[model samples]
Target: MLTTRHFLFFLTGLCCFTISLRAEPAQFEPEAPAAEPGLAFLLPTDQFLRQELDEPDDSDPLLPPPLEDSFSQVEPTPNPDTESLPDLKTLLRPRFDISAEWEPEADGVEMISSDLNLKLPLYPVFGPPPPFLTAGYSFTRINAPVQLDLPRDLHQFSLGVSWMRPLNERWLVRTMLSGVFATDFYNTGSMAWQFRGGMFAIYRPNEEWDLAFGALATGQEDIPVLPVIGATWRPSSSVKVNLMLPNPRISYLISESETRQQWAYVGGGMSGGNWAYNLRDGSPERLNYREWRLVVGWESMPPRTPGRFQSPGASYLIEAGYVFGRKFEREHQAADIKIDNSLLLHSGIRF
Candidate 1:
């Protein structure tokens, strides 16, 4: 049987906890950072978004504060130049991205999915700013055995807002709220709609470490609610250790230049979705698909430039991994079919 014990061990080894010395003192730049969407504790999509927001940038103007008191102590510094608000162009800029994934038939099951996402920045009347508005749509095609009797096509549409704010020099809070319609088109009533949300509190004592705690409402049958706890440790300029649930990864910088950089990472996580649909005779049913994956992948993207309001022109990612613990379940039924381990391949692009 597949379990979470191995996943826990894998997270522990990613960070050995040895790098203790603090880096040189640095200044904190005040700007309207990007918003993080989705539940950090449950979905791979949200995890990927967090990774993008945290990626090292060539023009990053802020660095860890001077070490004082204990490793856990961080004092806020005042920035006198942050009184002005962002311009209209920066507030209205939008980002667009698209991705596709495929998995070959294994034990009579094959799957393909694609996603499109858009994010729009918002202007604040005063103070900092409000959350960004996000919209997304995804479609999945499943090829299964005749005996399974499942829907061939599934769809999910979501709209939400995400925001993050600093509580002090050492703490940041992030939250997301979204409503999703997950169904097979045949089911178009309230049965197909569900709401999910997440809130996370992050502690950053320095530039090298970030500790986080939060909770998530997944709106799924198996695990409806979950606690989010994790930490990010950067021991050097080129390595990052992310010890988090659902998805955990360790990345190493491979190559870099003024324009673009590349990195390779090995990681494992959970992926799947839950949907509602109608049978031929008008009976309502819920389908849940779940899978665990371990993979190595490489990603390429342009370095972030300060005051660059728009999104990156383009980015690319490709990965392949071993997939196991795959299963399909039908609610209010006795059918719980297990799928054999298979190979997974995925590629994505953003612009």
Candidate 2:
């Protein structure tokens, strides 16, 4: 018997001999003629090539064929003319506006006096009256005095918020709310608050002209109801001049008493110009009492783009007024109490 290695070598040699004997050559077919080197091949079964050869090729301009004018006699359809549409932007308008201000002031005070007398003297000093003389002498005396010192270092602040809504391109409705806070004059460490609201009919007929007519209402502890008619003229964007007639209603109670008195006042104020930080004193007639106040202060609106009607980022206001004159009292039988003039100042934000 042969070894396993010799038998494996003999089987490999026999497989190689069998593979060489089975190898065969492929049969060749004849080649067709080549027309043009760059031309794409077309199948013999293509539909266009199967049609009749008599039809003329309209694609090749260099090859002219005999033609009758019958094809040219076909009429062409005409297209209707259409107009271009206008853009939406050209049919609409844009508007913008803004208003705001700040005010601050210092100095304020109040004083009071009272008379404790209730009865008249029995004896007539000048003349004899038939019915007046009471035999017994009973005299009633009246005398009382009170004084309040307001804080000497006083600060008051105010802020205003205004909105303007466009009515067409040149007109707007304007409204505003303003609030003020300051240290109480008599209480020293206490605070006082005042609020005011205004509404206006504003007209801007041209770029260089502005006019407004409005009414304002202001409220506080001493002067609870203040109604005013206001007008403003703006010759330029940064300049404004204003005039106002304010009717202030004042209410006060007698010292250590429950009796309250209410009175109305009509007054007027004038400011130099828009950017001017000066206000002339306002003088108004008192209805039930004689009272006077002198105010000098500055107010300014927030800076904003001319056409952007929006809330001001922040605003400040200041006012300093002095109260003088007299107040009558039934307790003070002989004379009225004099209110010494004092300073009031305030400053704050609009929000």
Candidate 3:
């Protein structure tokens, strides 16, 4: 039902309206010319599971970087425009993200969640080196009305490796493999384990455009595998258009200085997770919750360091959104419960 309404369609309409009112035409000058494009910025849904390369170096040039909803970081690509590879030391820096989200009581339920993710670059003295080693932990607490049948607490722990290898001047391959344990902590076993993986071919014809095609395995019941078709288009120095599944957004540059930049964005996406738990009857079951989100947010980030590759600098974001199409389903049940739409608040800091 929610998919039919296509919340993403409405989000796109609203995003375009905001862009038209504030976006201004500006000259485009790319100082760096080339680096690994940021897929995390392009696709927020898989932010924690993947890696992105390089931070936004405001001085190095290229259109202003787009807003990142999930703050995923990856390894930087060696500039294809240059003959030499990027210095290994520059790519070894680590990036960290911390975020929290809340949905106030609505339709008999409320939820709060927090996440911590780290992206660390890895290298080997011999053979090819892996680009990144990522680890994350998440905790969620749900307060439900007496009538609801749900677990009060849930947790997820993940570890993964991300790799990016350039095929040529304009093409690159990025892939990630991760194992996740999602449970109520009471049900800690194979039943709680889930595997996620993804691979994409990215095409950066120039500094202003990036096109990616691939699929992501989410390990959820309702939609286990999600296709990844995404594009990033910078129409001007002040505006960026991101067309991607699960999360799509348009961002406008609000202000900028030599060391920092601020942004405003409107976007929407699918948000939910699945976990395993033991029922009071001693039966092991899986619970899946799903929803759609429409959000407007603001963020601030430091400029990219010159010459040295860096993850996105310490940044912060605050967002408010509408959550709809909410539902809870069980692994082998004939019936599901639906909840009324509600408002959500989210904020995060990354360093």
Candidate 4:
């Protein structure tokens, strides 16, 4: 089963790899800089163990002291004995994020959504979850004219769990499960089971690139089954391309003297998930809602505080975007109805 993210990352990597293979490879810049933990704000929301997956909060990491060591040698120099390697579970830690998005009514329709995610590295109450476990909750609501449209409240709540583990030094696995609860009436034959699952084996060829392939699937009717093949690359300290995928961003680090560890990037990705709701004063058929998003945003950490890894993480963000290619599809309404493009305005905290 492929989630939206599975497809996003998959397509992103495939496109980038194809282009790179065709073009001559340039000398990589200085063994690719460590993925800065401060940029956790830039991660894709749909990823499992997000911050940890890319750059876990490691107080002390046992990585090769020199970049060349990772590529040239199977074992690093300082650690002649591989048995003494630090366990990744110790480097992993709990992480959480919360954010909300809203769009003004367009064509007499409006939508709002919010999400909260927590990665429980400390799940055993005494120790950590062997690999890693995460829990997420999402709430969405779409308001429309009751008189003109059916009295269907297109609201949904989703609870999901994600499990991740490093299969080996070069491969990591991520899987997810989500359940849907809707605020609409349905018959015994109707049920809204928005279950989605994905499995990806990701490989880090070097410090700057991550390659992965898998499959993403969903039980929802609107979203399609996606075969995953993706790539994540950072050509330089400030430029990153996720390929033909979601959450691609280009950032500029502001002067350090600015008090806040300030940085800004403009990014965008696919938004909206399938929702099932019954029609009123009509047939027993239901409808599915979906949309695509394009956003430009700026986010910065709280000033004069410990960084995201050390203390509770917090960031200020403001984003303006547009949602288009919106549609509603179902059996009775077999034909998808196009919704007008709407302006998206969002102000939220990521903590």
Better TM-score candidate (2, 4): 4
lDDT of 4 at 282: 44
Q: What tens-digit string does per-residue lDDT give for candidate 2 at 1-351?
A: 224663354345434433443312111100101100100111110111111000111111111111111123454333221122222231111111111111111122222111110111112232111011101111111121323211223333444443333444445454546554433233222224445555555454544333445554543333343332333333432333433233221112112212212221222222110000111121111111234444444433333221111223332334455444434222113443344443332222221
Query: Can you give the TM-score per candidate against the true fold?
Result: 0.77, 0.29, 0.76, 0.66
The lDDT-based order of candidates, best leading, equals 3, 1, 4, 2
Name the 10 consecutive residues with the lowest summed lDDT in model 4.
23-32
Task: Find the number of clashing residue pairs for candidate 4.
Answer: 8
**Candidate order by TM-score, highest to lowest?**
1, 3, 4, 2
If both were scored by lDDT, which would come out higher, candidate 1 or candidate 4? 1
C-alpha lDDT of all candidate models, in order: 0.62, 0.26, 0.64, 0.49
Candidate 1 lDDT score at position 17: 16
Model 2: number of backbone collisions: 31
Worst 10 residues of 1 by lDDT: 17-26
> Model 1, residue 225: displacement in angstroms?
0.9
Over 1-351, each residue of candidate 3 has an lDDT whose tens digit, in order, gives: 234243454345334533443322111111222232334444334334433322211121222222221122664455643333445544444556666677777777888777777666564442143456788888888888755668899998888876665555566576778888999988887879998877877776666787778887776767777776777777776787777555777889899997678989998877778889877676788988888889999988665443333334457788899999989899877789898898877777666
Give the C-alpha lDDT of model 4. Answer: 0.49
Q: Look at candidate 4 and tell me the lDDT of residue 301.
A: 58
Model 2 earns a TM-score of 0.29
Candidate 3 TM-score to native: 0.76
Which of candidates 1 and 2 reaches a greater TM-score?
1
Q: Give all candidate RMSDs, comma-separated.
A: 10.7, 47.5, 10.7, 12.3
Q: Considering every candidate listed, which one attains the maximal TM-score?
A: 1
